[model samples]
Target: MHCSTPKTSASLDPALLRANFPIFGNHPDLIYFDNASTSQKPFVVLDEVCRYHTEQCANAGRAAYSWSTQLDRAIEDTRARVAKFIGANAEDLAFTSGATESLNMVALAWGLLNLQDGDEIMLCQRDHKSAVLPWYNLKDILATQGKTIHIKTFAIHEVGDYDLKSIKDQVSPRTRLLAMTHIHHVFGLDMEVAEIREIVGDRVLISLDASQSVGHIKVDVAALNVDFLSFSGHKMFATTGTGGLWVNPRVKDSLRPMKLGGKSEATPEAGGLNLKHKNTAELLEAGTQNIAGILSLGKAVDLIDSIGLDAIESHVSDLTVYLYGKLLNLPGIIFAPGMGICRCEAGFGIMSFRFEQISNLDLSFVLDEENIFVRSGDHCTYARDTSEEYIRVSMHLYNTKDEIDQLIAVLEGVVG
Candidate 1:
């Protein structure tokens, strides 16, 4: 199926695009608004995964057989394709399980090796726990080894973006790294990464969790100039357990492998075992990878490329504006901090809000009964002022204005 928008720059046909996904076919009335959590798989990605299992079921880089060689070539080709998709070199990207593992790798392999006593790492308090917890874990692990590392946190502005002033004020000579997100999972706003680089200067390493922005927006690693970038494929229409981590070659040598297995080379010496680990992106890939999932991720990249990020962004932006306008009309509705005031201008297609009288959990159950699926929780964030949960509605290219209208109608009924 041709998923691309018209050359005349017309809006995408969500109804037509929805045909490519089998989930909608199974549940025709289902309204999927929790796209930030994970997107429904397309037929192409599913078929690619099945093809790999059926045609050539062999381990990558294991043997000299035809199946192994074919699998090895496929994996390398996918590595190059996925790297190019994010404007990066193949040598700088490594396949991982997902964003969680990728972020953990940065903490264990890079942070553990490079950081010293009194070196501080900066993190955003409102970011996801996956991005925040790994560093704190590193701090605890280092303390046992007698190295005292300090963790500093910065706050976000009312517009759901990083507080540039807060970041600037916190940077010190001992600040080694700043871990942040590309697009906030709950706020849906782009964190303005380029501005962040200017504030922290050239000395501080920036590690970005691009879980929400990789397939949703145009991400150029060179332009962002971050030391490390991580994202999950499941959130981008690929299977779970497939993701990529891109490391800048300048900092490649600073990362020590956290895990070593079959592929890593070592030789016996008179003194000890001499470990030979390549200083490229493949240094961390020590075990057999998720071969089928990685192939599906490559297909996901192909599908996204055919559709074009510009068109996808435009379609989702229009949906966000429509959804935000309708939600504003709700009688006792309250948006998350900085969300209502932004007026759907800064972010991608994500919104979190709640009603004055209705409990967010109750509303989620009600919506689920109505076949409208939304996420209701703290969204796995680290720092929140209230324990109250909010209803999150995230959209994608396959979502339609009609679906948003149905959600608003249901919400209005509950309010009335």
Candidate 2:
């Protein structure tokens, strides 16, 4: 679904927003166009993380000390904050290192438990390795488990568009799960999760890898109707080594927890080895936890909300559209025809293209020499049909028109 809210008289002041990030100050000439990889943290997030480690450091949820108790509430409150940010229930959300573990958690916990002989799982060619390998691991285990499982990869249009009718054809009585990314990292294809959900219905479970979609766009879990979703914090202006997994409550009891040890949320006996895990996310979390990183993640939710998601989406889209217009006149630049210009909805602030005169790596190297950063190569999309390495220019709220102009100027010189 698209977010097309009416623009207020006072639009986002990107310069003021850019000033909030410390990295820009540290390197005066740095043009960070690699947000799809990881976002630079705002001072608010950095301060929150710093405060957690220096002033209130403690292991949460286990100790009787006052610090631990307070930290426990703080951690849980962060969970509530993220849930509210995504329009999800706090009880349905759980903490993980990042989306990778989140995807793996669902694959091992749910897929391994539920999938058996005659059951089929569908994945797309563009899915990240994190999303693909977990299912592949499950496929490998099937032989030892004495089960027959079928895995299928459906085709997308050459322009990175999903064919819902083609997808419907792939589903059958044996089809159990449809695991794909809500926004593709390479092509920036925003799969119609709502429409895909309608296609699957109650017959096939939907697992969405929303690592690219979450912070870039406004995503309501209720609207998407996904059984499981995985997204990272570093991609969202939060600290790295922190992210989340959201499980639909309808199947919470069905998916077992992957990591388990020590005390839990509701277990009464102290130091009990084998204890009952509460139905909530406490069953999923273990060990000392990334207290600092999680707190920063909570702050990121607040930061994004304060800016307003609609404004962020609108601003990023405008920048992408403007960049596409400038690049179209340049020589030998190639992506899906009309992709960045016409299908701005499909490409969420990311433009992946190739320059015929220069190799993708050389193009990236030249951009880096100018202090303009972008990711190049396959972007972890090994399953895709495209053979040539590509240049990926990803934008964010802090990206100014001047930066895009600089990028276009450099590109023109290279092509000319």
Candidate 3:
């Protein structure tokens, strides 16, 4: 282990930030490099969850008990925190299981309400299954209704960088909706969002799958001018069952609720009220809700803010660039073009490469034997043609320079 002294935070202290995460102290040897999949929770978030279950364990908007009231407050507080983090109004944010559920809610509900024959939904090939599958499923259903479901994709150049012109050209007057990720999960390339919005020019509604970009970087949905956005709490250091979806005020009334019943009505005028006709967020979310998970989400947001996203991003870029340089020099290692550490405009915490002589499964197994965990395969991007698979190592704030060195050491031994 390397000898180190704690640095005092002039802004948000990294050392103080480290103390807030129990996992960092408890598992000193564990190098968690798979942050793109899900981030480890900090102690503050864990305590929030523990405190909620132990003291405020009750349902919200129900019986008039003290615990229930506390639960309701906690849930609403999380909604506010999430909204502030992304620059959206709290009333526009809706809770769901995760990004997967949030996305499905939008696709199934919004697709049913607005989509018709000859309408188009454009997406990127690099989106995760959570963002891709729901809309694809809805497309199938729409086809049965005699509505044409046209799929248009924005292409990435051979170097893994996006060709913004391709997306600009793909948008037509008939395009009704566009759903895509804010960042490419496979390669960690940030999407051209503002440019895409300009090209669409209010002719179509834009939905962003912000699951990968929200916690890692700064996201302002209002400034970006997106109609819808979905992100998971687990990816941002909260519990897995918690996530939120943003529905812009413009199309709030148009959003439908695919699931309903149990604590969803504002005021039931009839015996069975209309679930799909409520106000913005309420119309989309209908359930008991994950009260504890939502509370933890607020804590996670606080933790990220205290540490500072800009500092974390800078450190991660440095680490990734260093790793890229070392890996590029190794024999039999296949390096994707335009991927070198972190460019100011392009890549971030995630980077993917492969070994020419070794299969992806074999490479991942060998790396795991050394306890250097890394992701392998297509990584759920359905649009990608599988001519070549990859091995992925995604870093986060908790990861250190030494850990990146260790990853290189193990890969060198395995490949050699």
Candidate 4:
């Protein structure tokens, strides 16, 4: 199918962009379509991480040495870069191991403070395990304290897109928090957060899990008016073991740090040591951070900025639309009529589908045989689907129209 939309080529040539990623050079024939799981890192990002580890490896925010100072500076620089990427202040962003840890920090912190008997926490059914399990664990903890954690779900219609009307009706005065993923990992659908805020207003605190959205597209916390946002670097072509949380400055004081450690201790000189801490990003960061990973994350964000999010968004939209069209023509391919289409104010490079004639795992194995990599199963979503019948194809900036054509040809040979 021809893309009728006018194509706007990126400033960075597709070949040069592909060359930046080391994985492509290593396996030139590999068609990686599982970016939603984790993105392949560019040479710049890999070098940044390697440089920190090999030349200037030291702990951050502690001690008084040149290496330590360098480490501290790099970490701070990364924080600033991440903050700018999401249109937030550096003070509002806290480094975590990854999106899972970031989500847990806020969910557990808020759950400890606000949850009580008969309080409900609103969650959408489309959430990933990283976004959903944190709250479920908190619910268990709250239950032991004579609090029965109530759950209210926002339904995804039969077509797999989120139904905003369900969210509007689920939110109530007793709702303590509303946890939602900005992008649905399985279907690649996005939510209208502004509409959500309009429907629920400030009556409920909103936490946005941008694990699949953040790096693939632009995220503006101020514009979205969300209380919290979580994202991971690995999903954005950076090294693993790096992610962050953006907390609204207004609620900074209210959120108690769940992971307190060396950096978390402000006053160690006083007779007995103080646990009460200043409400800043440091409070949530806790220990000596992942210096190398953080720097690599910053480099990845810089690379994205250099390429431009507008170009990335347009590239992915067209690629997914093309792939969706091709998949529809293939026999046994099952996807929503609006499968490749996204309703996000901003979209990403992702699409998901199912197969009626073959098992998803078997289909994935067949694709693997052809040197194609795609993700199958619920994609780390335990509550969403138990069967491994769902298949997802997630692309990135390095991907091109030819790659989609290759994927379609391979699938046609295998499944058709």
Candidate 5:
């Protein structure tokens, strides 16, 4: 592997990690390249989920009973665990349905609370619909208050390079928030948000969707200096509908809750109104908690930590380089780092492309017939449509060189 980093991190054995996932045992020949959608959970995370339902099943933070106490403790501990995992305080994180819900909460709560007339939010075409939709859906609501939200995009060349000038030009003093993704869903474009932060200064609140890169890489919320960030637990090997949002400590008071009910992650008073609502995670998460999923998500973080982030990053980066090298030589493969429009090498979770001879769906079918799985089409960038439909081959810690080789063999005959 001619990667910029080391070829492999032998400290964490990829084969051993692969064995921990049950799907490999069930289908030995299966090559799961759609990890960006949802990752295959390790037995550790599954066991934690089952254990929660079997042993300590109870509603959290409601009753003084032992079961409720146990469940509540588990939920809070997991919250702290997830918080530390992302380099933030426990209070900064809030459990939600997923990144989508988390982002929506920010848009509906923070945007509604702070935005005024002539304020704007910046986004880009590369953003997944979930990233854009949350803010995009707010135009009408703001209009009622005589507010007009001017949405803008960061100018990106077809080659996927950032136009720094456009970033400086677009982010005016009236910009309220800059909403974008840490990694583009379609083609694995890992954006350097630190630079974007520098350009925007403190003019706008930076809300990042780190759904694609959080568990796979080392993401320090403090270091990124973002006001708000959201990520998916399912994509990080946790349960579906399990994720959290990180709200900057300073902004928690300004950001309101999207879902509210009679649940005591807080204390109630004799007046039937809140005596005190702590500005921690409790402020954002309301209603009955997903204790089982939250516990399992904690276990998922444990599984990733066991391998070590540096090792995991090294392994995937190497495999991506290897896959790029093999696939680039093939004719008609477009938009991968070394092929088509993008000239840089593929370095993250996905390698997306459109083939010349075969449609993406047809290619997906052929791979499916071979027991090789992949994802095709626009991949939920619903607003951003190009002339070509792209297929994404996303990788995880469990993926190996052998599986990549098998994929190359399948594509060689079809495209040649």
Candidate 6:
């Protein structure tokens, strides 16, 4: 299917879009605001996933039977569709379990092979732990091999954006790679990666964790020019256990497969064994793929394409501003530092805040009682302090101002 260009509009109708999701019908009182965790699946995606499992169930790239071949072709088609969704080539994208595995693949498969003893890796304390911990794990593994790798820390500005000055000060000649988030999970602000690319120059490879940005905004890898980009499918309206890693053609050869089994070729030699692997995106895919989830991802991309990312972005941004304005009116409300004020012009549909007198956990329990779903905790960032937790309200196109109004009314009653 031909992907349609995203259309920009003044607004979208939330009540109409909400009809496409069955979850809303199943639970009439549910007001889902935790989009950063996982988006509710549209009927198109759910039906496609079910259809593939029941009617066209077969293993891809394994056999020449009609069902198997059909599945294989469908998988490749989905691969191209998903790659196009991010403005990347089909050969450059590889499927993984999720963003966590994708990040780990880069650390183990690429970092293990390319990083040297004196090389330094840059990371942000405010980014998700999945993006930060993999590199540290690489450091530990390299330590056992008698190699020293340094982890340089960067900062996030008071406004929740990347601290460009901090990055400039910390970047060095030995900095081999910089791992960062495209959009902050907790602060819900775009990290401005293009500026980061300018600071690091062309030498340092960049690995971006785009778990929060891809489906929510217009993400073009060609424009960002990052060496590696990773994201989870579930966060973007696809099924769980589905995600992708896009490698820049310049760095694709640098990655060595971490998992090896079926489909990987090896030959015996006099000295030992010689491993032969394709340098394309398939290099990282060693075992049988997630056939059902991947097919659903294609449908999700199609749905997004039909709705247009511009429309989704506009709708969600407006909802975020509305939510922020209402939250600000509530007395004793304290937004997460650096995210205290809503940047109407910038930022995705996410915000974190807490009440001065009410504990985050208590507030979450009260909100749950009201059937208002929200996330409250450290939000999986390395920099979070468990003692100072905040509640996260992440919006999507299906959400409405009426829901936000309800949330505000509940808070008003509690705080009153």
Clash statistics: count for each candidate? 0, 0, 3, 0, 0, 0
Please, what are the lDDT tens digits per residue for candidate 1 over residues 1-416?
A: 01122233446778988999999999999999999999999999999989988987889888999889889899999999999999999988989999999999999989998899999999987898899999999999999999999999998776566778888888999999999999888887777788888888889999999999899888899998999999999999999998989999889988787787888765669987676766555588988899999999999999999888878888887788778888998998888754565664534788888888788889999999999999998889853554435899999989999999999989988996
The pairs that clash in candidate 5 are none
Model 6 score (lDDT): 0.86
Tens digits of per-residue lDDT for model 5, 200-268? 997679999999888988889989999999999999899888998999987888876676777634445
TM-score, each model? 0.95, 0.94, 0.90, 0.92, 0.93, 0.95
Error of 1 at 330 (Å): 0.4
The digit string of per-residue lDDT tens for model 2 on 1-416 reads 33233243235878999889999999989999999889999999999988988998888878899999999899899999999888899988988899999999988889888988989999875667888888889988886899878888775666665667778888888899999888777766677787887887886888899998888788889888889989998899999998899998888887766766665544436664444666557778877788899989999999999998878877877777777788888888787422553355324787888877888889899999999999998887663454435898988899989999999999988996
Worst 10 residues of 5 by lDDT: 1-10
User: Number of clashing pairs, model 2?
Assistant: 0
Worst 10 residues of 6 by lDDT: 1-10
Pairs of residues clashing in candidate 4: none
RMSD of each: 3.5, 2.8, 4.7, 3.3, 2.8, 3.5
Question: Candidates 3 and 5: which is better by lDDT?
Answer: 5
Model 5 lDDT at residue 28: 90
lDDT of 6 by residue, 276-334 (tens): 76655668887888889999999999988888888898888777777877887889988
Candidate 4 vs candidate 5, TM-score winner: 5
Q: Local distance difference test, per candidate?
A: 0.87, 0.82, 0.76, 0.78, 0.81, 0.86
- Cα error, residue 307 of model 3, in Å, equals 1.3
- Candidates sorted by lDDT, best first: 1, 6, 2, 5, 4, 3
lDDT of 3 by residue, 1-416 (tens): 00011122223334455666787788666667778888888888889889978876778868788877767877787788888999888888888888898888888878887887887888866668887778789889988888877878776666665567877888888898888778667766766777788878886898899888888777899787888899989988998898888888998877666777776664556675544345666777677778788888899998888777777666666666677767877778775433643333324677888887788788888877777778888888753454446788887777776788888888788786
Clashing pairs in 2: none
Candidate 5 regions exceeding 4 Å error are: 1-11, 264-275, 336-346, 382-388
Model 6 segments more than 4 A misplaced = 1-7, 268-275, 342-344, 384-388
